[model samples]
Target chain A: MSDTLRPNSSDDNQGAQPLYVPIKRRSFFMYAGATAGATALLLTGCKDDDDSSIDAKTTVDVGVGDVGVLNYAYALEQLEAAFYAEVLKGGYFTGLAPAAAERQIFADIALHEQIHADFFKTALAGNAIKALTPNFSAINFGDRTSVLTSARAFEDLGVAAYNGAGRFITDPKFLVVAGKIVSVEARHAAIIRDLITPNSFVANDVIDFSTTSATARQERSKLPAEVLAVANTFLAESSKVSAKSLV
Target chain B: MKLLSLLDRLSTADAPAAAAPRRDLLHRLGQAGARAAVAALPLAAALPAQAAPTDTTLDAILLLLKLEDMLVALYTQALASPALAGAAQAAVRPDFERMLRHQQGHAQFYRTTLLTAGLTPPAAPRFDFSGRRNNAGNPELFPNVLNDYNAFLQLAQQLEDASASIYLNQVAAFATDRQLRDVVLRTQLVEARHASHVRTLRRTATASVAVKSWPSNADVVPSPAVVVPSPAGASTPPVSIYSFEANEVQLVSATTAVPFLAVLTGATAVQFVALSEAFDEPLPTAQANALLNIFG
Candidate 1:
């Protein structure tokens, strides 16, 4: 189980290169406004070299450092918020009784995800990434099993993403805020899992429960690159996100 | 004072003879002092001149170890209680078992982390879930915690919620070691999962006790019937685990709030509830210790 959970080293190596170096340069200019003349010249020289080999349209790098981590989270939240918004309008939700627990649950979660997405946008301000377009063609929201299974995947992935990204945040305040949000994501994941199949909230798949070690019940976290691989599937090609610098 | 003394013992009991030099301890204390000074600038003049020793990483680990130890004892005893032996609880017994296993794992993790750092964790406390401080003469704040399923679930929900808050409070203190910080983050989410599961159980079991999977202002306040007396003999309000959870405004800095109400506008009431429920507030270490001491 641990072997499978171990991050793919080769994938991580691929993620180490800055595929979206231009994005970072663009945001840096937006954030710093007018830099000193000498500094601007040095930055432009480096920018041209980065643009020569990489097509920025093909992939969206979340940037680097704390901003990259924030964008990584922002990207995931956007996906969740979009998925839940679609779920609310789908046949399955509309078909349920107005007062049904499932309906209320979906409504509450929709609000939560939107709150998360909007919060990141506000917090990041100028450094925030443009909203990515969601591609939910794979999801049949009219069906309960399909919508819920996708929800469970997103919630679990969100939790793992935040958990894994914590070490990368240099700012204590950001880490603290991330801590506040990740638990809510965990709560959502648990309830979603429970709704799908009772008593599976802390199942072995999301949590390490290997018998070889008595103390191996920690929750498993996924690196940013690992999370993006699954998240990009629900995102449109042009809007697909990457965390190359995050690795 | 009892709680403070107990924490003092837990913080100091396992120190090795070859502890860090006094100068090093003072240096760490100075850093903590600066942080506390900034945090308490408004009240600095009114406060005492002598500063107490601030929590180090070692203290944080020990405090969490103490918390996990109490949780493990609570779940272990509850599983054995005849109150949960009936058919209704039979369906949820697996949940209890799984939660217990995770808590035991957490406790072991903290203990091992301490040992790895060359510090010994203190022995687990004898937990009394009735909130009597293990004294028969004292008033029982949670009378049916072990005998009634509803009572058990109520206490369990609060404990789990408090556990998540306590972990959040300590995460930033571990910034010096990113690996340890990430581990704390991982463990903290599991605690949140546990809290959500317990809250869900409560919501489904009894409609009378209003609760959502996440903390919300709409949830009924889980207060003790009797106000416990402070050591000073004044009636102390019951220690609430969710005391700070109903905060709607979040601060990105000292002066500015996240402005959730203005930004996420709709029905004012619904927005207010969502704003508060969106973020779980951190419990101060002193408050957490006080809450834990209720079950000492």
Candidate 2:
């Protein structure tokens, strides 16, 4: 049993080995086995952190790789979904223009966010992090101005987050999924912006000035850290998402 | 030997036959030099292989650049039209100018990218929005795209919507290059915004216009522009721009059709329009290219 557990000491004695043998093959398998073992340990070590019973004050590390980015997205979706769900429950705020249009758009947007949140939840399955609790105490759900303004902020932040995180995603399918979802977020962003101020959908504030063309402008992209910093302000201590591993 | 091995690895997966013709691929390699190929191996591994037969980076970039160039020309012509700057549409001239600037900027960006890739960017084609192909002999499809503001808005809405779909079509092909994918996706959404804004402009201009911020089933609504009658000896009837957008069914995956009405938790047939509006479908590459040929 002791010999079985020990490293192959004989294999390390290069002088005794045949000179014509391929050394690279043995080393490759040895590294592959070590990596597989480390990966298993890393995954298991983070399982408890993903539990639903996570304390509100706990700092949750959205672990690296595809799962990490999806969770990061999940957290934002959860926040937006919760916000819209609450807004719909309370009814449209006063002073909302074209009341019927606003109500319908808001309802549709709320459903879209909820669907996005649920989709990520299903995709991550057992690896998904705890449901984030958004702290919207400061936002007045009764006022159309406040609610729409908050929606704009959330939609813009969501767009920026997805745009910024695109480069970090390693899987092509995951990136395609992100692309599918991000455009919806963008459409939502445009609608919310236009609702707030007509024709200001892609205003310079949210879009960076174009250096490539004198007249062309591009939408702004935010790094994970910058986005999370803004996002955490609306999230409670326990539900705060950390993308340190992702970056 | 290492270079030969590198070539072998790259070709094996994609070769049509054991000894596939690779003149273009080999020419690219020859131009890149042997040292660059050696350096590019690790980077090449990061590029996601696409299954589409013609979705090469050069093709995607060239197509996108052409689309942008067409847009720049369209907007420039619209802004230049004395009718647009007159009293009837005077208030919206600044907005049209803004749109023109964005298209010009987009066109410039695409040109720079092509040049940076060491490819010669195609020259701007003489665009005839009248759809007469600059030849009086050909029948006109869009007769009032530039002179009439309402007609202009309708055409603008169609172009912007088409732009969004075209970008969506090409975006997946860029998956291999993270930087390019990022740029494409970011730019794609801006097109979406532009589409929405154009739709709003149309709706505002005509209270009865059946358009929405997002595309609805009403996408099938007949357009005032683009009356393409089949010529005397034509085989296939030309597809109208509005007809292209009025699609309800969409593919959520390669094989799965999104059950829009079933999955959409709402009431009545009107809500089906909302379901359609909820997702924009991608237009196929061949169709998109065909549409691009109309203005030039």
* Candidate that scores best on lDDT: 1
Backbone clashes, candidate 2: 3
Q: How accurate is candidate 2 locally (lDDT)?
A: 0.66
User: Candidate 1 lDDT, tens digit per residue, B1-296?
Assistant: 33334434544554554665432332332243434533433212222211122455556777889999999999899999965777778988999999999998888887776554444568999999997788899988788889889889888988899899889877756665566677788899899999999998988884446788999977887765322223222366543456467767666554556666566654222456877787876666666677777776
The residue pairs found clashing in candidate 1 are none
Extract clashing residue pairs from model 2.
A56-A238, A216-B105, B48-B176
lDDT of 2 by residue, B44-92 (tens): 2332122232445556677888888888888888888854766877777
Give lDDT tens digits, candidate 2, residues A71-100: 888888889988887887664533455546
Provide chain B's TM-score, model 1: 0.78
Q: Fraction of true contacts kept, per model?
A: 0.68, 0.34
